[model samples]
Target: MIAALLQGCGRGETPVHVSQFDAFGIRIDMQLLGAPEQLATEVAEQTAQDFALTSYSLGLEQPGPMQRVNELLATTEPFAAPPALLPLLEQTRDLSERSGYLFNPAVGMLTDLWRPDPVTGKCSEPPDDESIARLVEAAPTLDDISLNGIELLSDNPAVKLDFGAVIRAYAADIAVANMRARGIRGAMIRIGSDLRLMGDRTGQPWRVPVLRGSGGAVLGTLDLRGDMSVVTVGRFQSPCFRNGKEYSRIIDPRTGYPAQGTQVVTVLNSGDAVTAAAAATALFAAGPQQWGQIARQMGISAALLIDDTGHIHLSPAMERHLQIIDRNAQVSVSPAWQDSGPQ
Candidate 1:
């Protein structure tokens, strides 16, 4: 962005420590400005362990606990898991309910039918129409999955768990929490598309960019002044084609179809990346017409939704936060989400 243009703001050594690694099928870029080397190293190790505990990596000889839960849900018997998973399951259920079932972690069956091979990223063919329809009709929500203590069971055999919707965000939370606990002054943790910013660039807020079509153009800037989360959902990541039509990997559990109609949906919230990430996916699937309601229900005041037509809609809270540098974009502020002054 315009980091050089920024004046009157003095941040000490903007992110002196940087680390790059790959995990959970996505790349991770971490920036730490003022943190001890020994502690930073420990934080990195903890982040990876946390991700492994929460992610559902399939097609491996031994799947993680997330995948194991999916296997249990596929069967009739209850699967006993460690108490560590309680928070993950609990939060996912809350997100699913709040989003009106638009955010579903138990969508493993649906995703498996649409996605390519995880390692090679190639698909023989997309799932047939009949199979998709059948799975969509039978897809189970969190209400169908019961959790008691450390045991989780799905009464519906069709239910399968896939934490794709919010895994990265929650993992970022874990990493951020670890860093903060270890006396890190400021850190930016990005897991795939999930972003979490702690502290500022001296006196200025963290400048975050929202991408436009295919992520080539900058839609605007969301300056995060405090601890907050920002996430974007778009069709550009890991696209698949079927019958000469392209589709995003994200699936709308409500319709059992690969979600479209929105070029990108970016969400901002007070302090957690997981909810922001989940809401972005849910709103992206909900489409332009339904994003306002989804944001309201999820208590997200700041959001930007870009339709396939390149029209940008901003919520009241998001309008206050976003400084649009992209004049070429067709932008509009929604009165439904935010109120105009001097009315």
Candidate 2:
């Protein structure tokens, strides 16, 4: 089980409690503010446990219930589904349709092909073209999955379910809800740039910088108010190089290949982190040209995207929220995407 906010309590009055731990194959950072010392310590411990419990239930790290469920479901056997996962599946289905099937969760087989070795913590090389071609031809979708009451089955034998895109964000949603229920005041959660801010940061809006995937350039700063999730999908997070060519870990479900035409995509969600995470990846995969329509279909209010040419684009909604503190002529808003400008 992965632990939460660097173990134990922070000393002194209003001492900021911070935790750093690895979960879901990514390092997660969390900070707590404006909590009583006792509550801070308690929340930290509970946060760790929450991640651990979530991973076990979801079969993210170890052999847990979900793994067993997947094993049975991988074949043609009728298997009873975990009650908790069913709702997530339904949610993914709705999101997949809304994002034009770009936010997929049933492409586990393809993800596995790209996943690094468990021992090395790195992939030795990219998968062969033949392997990728086979998965692409199969083209699995959530539609192929059917549920008879609690029994779940996948008609497509080649299909496998992977929630890499949604798991952390969903967990963040649950954790945020749990904190609110506990009367927790303020918190900042980040799991590999799928960031969520709850309440305020010392009574001030959180100022966040969106970084370029290349040379760590600050594309812009987002001054976010209220509770919101900021999810950025970039090639820098996961990449494997072969023969001087770079490949991203984020594979396009449509082609069973890496998503193209964008350097980085950032998505904002005031409602839920799950949608924010999915939308960022989906919008990036939708590419710079098609992101506008997909963003509208997903009801995304604001986002900033860095294209392959280093051009920055912002949704009309972003202009109202983020003060472009670092444009430097490198970043510009698309008139077509400006909230009140000519479409």
Candidate 3:
């Protein structure tokens, strides 16, 4: 029973309503608002389709532009020169660099080794130590990979774009762009927990539930208005198990291990949902202290981090926007939030 409502003011029209279904492990919902009756259905359908096409990892199955791109990426030899694959390759390269090469080559190896089961789509146990060591030995670094006009290859011939981290956000960006171009004003696009919201809910804020667990029991809620986008990152959203030990899907590209210590982190920004989501994931992987430093350095607007110790850390900007309704919730506003200039 996933439901959302979008109400408009002075228009006297019924608020747009949307419901979601699970598609390829992603939650997809679409609703039309402030659009003419004839166009609403068309817009909704097109938007949903576009979102699915771009966001679904399995969408790589079809033989289309993106498919062609992915195939080239998958089959191309390490250090091969392929001009057609340059854009995506370059993008991947940049992300790796910006992430301090925290986007490590071993991460992909680990992901493949700890591959999710095809049948249940659940993560299986880590592969044999020999396999892991072989992968690690074969892992490529930025130095190994060179991108000159889209032809990418590692000197060692092992590292490559996993696309798992960036693909969802990329799709969200494309979908939002499509919606705006089609004159759709108010919409929420969520691929799994990665979400993007455009405009306000009419004149009011778009309320988002912040849950404590993957089961969706609410911890708190956020009311985002204007052009802001919100992205939540946490272990609770994507749980995995290995030999009966639980692990999160948020892999630390550096250690080829799952991130630990924090429960959930939310980032709000005026940028696209994809950027927000990616940044949030990276920051979460970086952990709390480093995350705070990065957020301050980047001038990030709002950040909320919930640790395993049941402590909540709110950035200065986030405090202005936060309404902590759970009295029993152990929360602490960061000094930055407390000292943030002039309300």
Provide the RMSD of all predictions against the true structure, rounded to 1 decimal. 4.7, 3.4, 4.5
**lDDT at 39, model 3:** 56
Q: Model 3, residue 168: what's the lDDT?
A: 62
Query: Could you tell me the TM-score of candidate 3?
Result: 0.79
Model 1 agreement with the true structure over 79-156: per-residue lDDT tens digits: 786565678778878988999888887777888888787677775477788888887888688888887777778888
lDDT of 3 by residue, 108-150 (tens): 5466666567567778666676765665556555455555554
Question: Considering summed lDDT, which 10 consecutive residues are worst modelled in model 3?
Answer: 55-64
Better of 2 and 3 by TM-score: 2
The all-Cα superposition gives candidate 3 an RMSD in Å to the true structure of: 4.5
* TM, every model: 0.88, 0.88, 0.79
Residue runs of model 1 more than 4 Å from their true location after superposition: 1-15, 52-62, 335-343
List per-prediction Cα lDDT, in the order shown.
Answer: 0.75, 0.77, 0.62
Evaluation by lDDT, superior candidate among 2 and 3:
2
Q: How close is candidate 1 to the true structure, as a TM-score?
A: 0.88
